[model samples]
Target chain A: MATASKAAADSRANLPFVYRQYSAEQLREVLHKMYLIRRFEEGAEESYMRGLIHGTMHLSIGQEASAMGICMPLAEDDQITSTHRGHGHCIAKGAEVKRMFAEFFGKTTGYCKGRGGSMHIADVAKGNLGANGIVGGGIPIAVGAALSSKMMKTGKVVVSFFGDGANNEGAFHEALNMAAVWKLPVIFVCENNGYGMSTSTARSTAVKNIADRAAAYSMPGVIVNGNIFSEVAEASHKAVERARNGEGPTLIESKTYRHRGHSKSDRNRYRTKEEIEDWMSNRDPITLFESELREFGFIDDRGIEAIREAVAKEIADGIEFAKASPSPDVSETGNYVYTEQA
Target chain B: MDAMVRELSYAQAIQEAMAIAMDMDERVFLMGEDIGVYGGAFQVTGDLVDRYGADRVLDTPISELGGAGVAVGAAVTGMRPIFEFQFSDFATLAMEQIVNQAAKMRFMLGGEVSVPVVMRFPAGSGTGAAAQHSQSLEAWLGHVPGLKVIQPATPYDAKGMLLAAVADPDPVMIFEHKLLYKAKGPVPEGYYTVPIGKADIRREGRDLTIVATSIMVQKALDAAATLEAEGIDVEVVDLRTIRPMDKQTVIDSVKKTSRLMCVYEAVKTLGIGAEVSAMIAESEAFDYLDAPIVRLGGAETPIPYNPELEKATVPQVPDIIAAARDLVKGVR
Candidate 1:
């Protein structure tokens, strides 16, 4: 009877999820990053509306927490593969925002010299593989990166970010199965922002939750509050640690909502205005983080105002840099087609 | 002053060149489905795994897409990987990796990366491999902007072209005819790199210029020999590389001969012959031509498994001889 009671007590003790405490400095840094991403995207939207941007852009307006939280645990050597909505991921992963802005502006000073435009910005130095336009394209690529890490014994992990809609892709299943069989050090993070384009998750996927799909691959699957930066950060930390320790890949479902339409061209007819207003007002990640930080005595009204002003200035500087950069030389069209031997 | 020339088959020459390259460079590795232990489906890479060991001579699963992706990734990351497709027909499975990623990566990335990868395919009909494994699809790859396409006809060109392909910085696709591997010619020993995008005059004559690729080169040479007996001396030009095609050499040969006949094993519709014919017609060589350019190619149809049917699907030696004879005679 005494042993049974002791076991029951231990089970109860492990029931509540333990969260990692953040200091004032850490909280401020997270807020600053979120504000920067928000401002950058907002500026991009204005530019697009003004006919400055040419190509299709999928902005990560409301999914700031997932990018910042996941990237917070990654080192400079760790790699990540992103989806089309990759501006936030790139920013959080420490890419120069000015270069990213220049990329969107189609300037030679952009990350890819304007060749990649909005969909394919990659910075190898920052360990960002690149953003992919093809659905589920980056899953297997991340697996390859993780395999390279294992083979080279670099102890580096790769994180692959995809949308909820990508779960239906054959590559998703194949990549996850391969990663599982080989115990690849990768993290499969699904940003389930309710819809994959105009198609809702309920209509496309049979399973209620994307996390449940992990059982097929026999890996650890967890659902987290994506709008809450602390929750996302803590969950990502555990997953990254597990992968680094050779425990194989993990599937994380970040249940969140995108405040904007899927892309710049979306009419928002699939969902109601009421749904958008509710998510924006009640489930806003930035607002939630601000309230939490204020409660923890980490920030006040003046600090928030200063952060907003600084972000505004950063956006303005990025635009100026992009406008001043030169276009790529047309004569060098055949350059770099192949690597020349020295 | 010339040494005695010996005859060799295309397969033997490719095998010899691969063996030599492996001996010369430690970084060069070959991988394909059943290429290692099976010696390749057509035996082009005979006993390579045993000689170079498994790490360098890898046998992969039958996943062309996955295998090509790995090769491209490895090539970009500092390893020189040579991939073999058991048959050229299977390349469709890897078009995404080849066309989209390998061909566009360096350009899209601002020239920061290089795909120094070589893919070899046993192309054309002759084998009773049916429609699934006996088509010549080099024209499809040549149409892409960044890829280098090479089709070597003679054993000597095979050896030299492969060496050049290994040395080149870009991704090169070498389409080897299944029937030509057993054909023979004299091959030099040791490290020799033939310049890519250069045409070679196999037979120098004045009556007409017969441009050919892969197996058609032998046929063109045979036709040239036959035409000489008929008092019509014909020049045969072997276009080793199709993409960065040797337009100058081809035009020079046409200007000298005044008549042109482009031949290939691929379908006549938009084949390498079409590109060569168009180039000749557009160049200064057009004014010197005594006869209109003629292109002889495979009929547009699936290569049937029946031996006779398969042989009929592609351009044969007799077909080239007849075509060259007609061109020399100014026949429509």
Candidate 2:
């Protein structure tokens, strides 16, 4: 017990003062969320290839830290609005993985009751507001949520997650300006994953750093190493702390990369294989966390194997649950069209 | 024996209705650009900020999208927000928030939440505001699902329809004609909620059924009276709510009148009139029609800054009268 306590304290002390140390069980929960997102995306890709899933699927393959890092600092009641690439954020915010899978499968057991596909899953019970398909759409919504929190005196914060493409949208500027003026409790996380669909951010945006835009709004802007889980976690923790302390919103530009194409159909015409291989081999967040834990003597090879096996089993169980869930009734298509109760 | 109540302008009726609703429900609040201190662009929200504090009657910045988004979020979280657009033309700026977010959230969320927000815009022409500030875009919103569109033409209907919009569980877009704000009529003094998705018969006759909306409703009634002098009895119908429209009322009126004419301030092509004409043609009343469904709407050209050109753009009283006369006489 003393050894485990000392290891946990050391891990906590190593992190920035903004982060709260987790017990072994809490650490397992965070790991479970990350693994669920990874497994869910893998399954979705397989299903898409097999023609079981229609429309586009924006996989959060190599950008798990951007989700888990930001979510770890939020309270259960804090709200979050996500972008089209949103499965990781939803999983991190405590949405049921099985239900999310069912949603992708268009089953009635889905979070949106099969009405919303992968890009628009919402679980209001879990404070996961919803995912938006439009670029920069969720920014204003998150600010509105923060306004609601302040008006209702809930002491809750809202996190708006979007890609680099959203930074150019007009709503992004308007939302940030309003949030700053009102000093709303919100966090704007820009997952600058190199590319927005086929276009690279370098060619699209004139500014090298998206975080620098926050200076115009008078908000604290920070850049984090999105591939390094600990660094990403440290940045998010500080931002969330500032929000919770009523110090207004923070803008975090997480520098990361996506292993997969923007959607299922792209053929990697833009980037070189060497670049992809370098990030996959050197900056993989899961592998880095595992190696750090092992070096700290927190777990041995057997324990690591056990963790992998548990994650695999959990994912397998979620897939089975999703497969068994029934599809939504076609006659009920117009059921939720309006809430007028007939 | 009933006593005659005092007559009030359409703007006055709307103000009275909002005041009554605000006094009754604490959750109800008014918000818009220039609504507070400025008393609204049309002075419809006159002295509201003074009567109610700034908190309840908010003056937003020039950000229409932000104001609309805030209203939507607030509506979903249990507040009844009555958001005003300075003019219906400015509503285009907030279309993304209104059409995408507020209109679809309930359906997307599996009916878990309701957006009880009322967006009031001063629509239609005759104000000489021109182009950007003068346009009728209710048909655009009515095309979208999960939204209730209302156009109140009379003082009584304005008060009753506004109350109904405020009490509605879904988002309602109330399009008030800029020309009819000063039009005066007798209105009862009290809280009354008229049912939406229903049409009111302004004049009943057997010659023809003239379906109109917003400013055209008054024009249609005027045409009906003129046609009545010529022994051409015409029935006029006011389509208060465009979406969830009163198809039954229009069909019944058309069946009885055996002739139909749809009038609107929108363009002649693909306007609300086109939809109503199609509905009448498709319904069982098709066989009972005495003449083809005639639609009198605005010309397909931009509303020019010149007052004469602007008048030519939309259906005026004379155009409605001429259309009614021609349809009744079986002349195109």
Candidate 3:
């Protein structure tokens, strides 16, 4: 008798179905997060090229929207396991840009206290399990975390992020089977950028869509256009809800592209420059999202300009924060080897 | 609440320690291959499944990499997980998780989180599991900085050390000797912890310090008993916790005895005995030593299935007796 339904009733921003009914403000926040990731990566690359950032880094310049869309549905307590090209994932998962930059600069105030550098960045309080250096390394860990949730009856889910190359690893099959059998609450998100380093997915992976392999494990398999912000959100929403309701795991393959070479060492010899340009010009996640926002009258030119300036300032502040932070003391290097403090 | 002390087998001791840990902490759970229903490969986890239920005593698929990774992940989050490898040799499959993820997460994450995970490995050469199954690879894990490698020799140490390992805030690798599972000793009931990174002197002597590991501790003590008739008092130090290598205990014993003999079941090259020998050489014990440091380790080859070859490969009671007799009689 009482119609207290408030699913989409608490919104004022006139945004359409691209985000499954996310209001204009929520859409703007998504765009903001994506911009932060994009600029953070550019800042990192610039520092690396200038010899300010130590060690090599893998940049996810083009795969920004996939990070935002997938993590958008997750709650604050939800967890994610990221890959080597993890800067975008970290930012989209809500990690502070300053600490991330500090980590890359090898400062004591960094995420890993200057020990992990780029590949092993983590924020535990934010429920990020940690980014892995090994391919397919975090799949089982995600499954395990999901198992802990199920065992404790906590009703929390975990999203595991990996590249296309990791699907070829033995851990992929093993982890999927275990998660399937137990019906653990985990989402295996594959960002298939068509390449695992230099080799294309065509050469390494025999399957057409990485999600199709999910059928073997008796789970839902869906593929989405990774560049489109709303499509990624729509695709992952069903899986996240199903996992939360205790259905099982889902394998969602978001088809995206990387604008830059795999790592700083990549020569871009695997794919042509023209092909890279084609993907960049047409399928850029930020550009398409901005165009969609204009079409829907959710945001205007001034809004777009203000958001860009703010992101640029935030990234510059992160760089300055990293540059000013000091290196860890040599004597303190041995302190964290064990949890025991004597 | 039972305070009465009773004899428990090495496997029983380890099982009791795990049971005590799980009962004490709700966050603790066990995961491994066929461990829940099949009672594990060696039956060390025989009755844990029935007692803890499937949720806590989980039976995992035959995927060491996945199981190990899951354990590391769970530990990194909040749970205290005890993962069992059917054979220590299978740890090769889990090298990435154990060495890379579990061991390094804390240091790599700047100590924001600690991997309170325990890995139980049924190791050593006595069972004739051969090269694929029965290799004593303690040295390989000990070489790593973040791992705490412990080879529990007796029933008491097995239970106490396992409880201690589960309580530890870091990854502890428990190398439970396959041969010592059935070996029995007096162990007290209820909660207790044998502090890790410390060695226990099983027997005290004045003539020589025979630093031994795992089952070799019992062998060294037996050898010492036989040498007692020959008027040779041998101090047998059970190097239970291998990674930390309690230098003070070994050094102090060597200083008192003025002679040392290092013995273990692993390969002589880069074995636990090498660390003991090097410790004496580096410490003030070197000046007090009456003779060159002697080490009795496994032969540099795969453990043979042949009974005689297996016995020949690892130092047994008789071998320790011979080594002790010779070392005490000024034999190089």
| Candidate 1 stretches greater than 4 Å from native | A1-27, A177-183, A206-223, A242-248, A296-302, A329-342, B1-28, B45-47, B50-59, B183-191
> Can you write out model 3's per-residue Cα lDDT over B1-332, one digit (the tens) per residue?
56889999999999999899999999999999888888899998898899999888899989999999989888877789999999999999999888888888888889888889999999988776778888999889999889999998988889999999998999999998898999999999988889898999989999999999998999998899999999999999988888877889999999999999999999999888888898789898899989999989999898999888988999989888887888888977
What local lDDT score does residue A239 receive in model 3, on the 0 to 100 scale? 86
Candidate 1, DockQ score (0 to 1): 0.37
> Which regions of candidate 3 are displaced past 4 Å?
A1-16
Error of 1 at A83 (Å): 2.5
TM-score of each: 0.88, 0.95, 0.97
For candidate 1, the share of real interface contacts preserved is 0.29
TM-score of 3: 0.97
Best by lDDT: 3
Model 2 chain B lDDT-worst window of ten: B1-10
- For each candidate, report its DockQ versus the true two-chain complex: 0.37, 0.61, 0.77
Per-residue lDDT tens digits for candidate 3, residues A138-233, read 899999899888878888889999999999998898899999999999999999999999999989898989998999999999899999888888
Q: Report the TM-score for the A-chain of model 2.
A: 0.94
Best by DockQ: 3
* Candidate 3: true interface contacts recovered: 0.73
Per-residue lDDT of candidate 1, residues A193-253 (tens digit):
9999999999999999999999999999899989888788878888999999999999999
Q: Which one wins on TM-score?
A: 3
- CA lDDT, candidate 3, residue B180: 92
| lDDT agreement with native, every candidate | 0.83, 0.85, 0.89
**Residue-level lDDT tens digits of model 2 in A1-342:** 011365557666755332335555555555556667887889888877888778888998989877988888788888899989999999889887778878888888889888888989888888887888878878888887887777677788899999999998888888888888888899999999999898998899988999999998999989998866667777887888888889999999999888998987889999999999988999877777667656655566887777778877876777778789999888888877677656
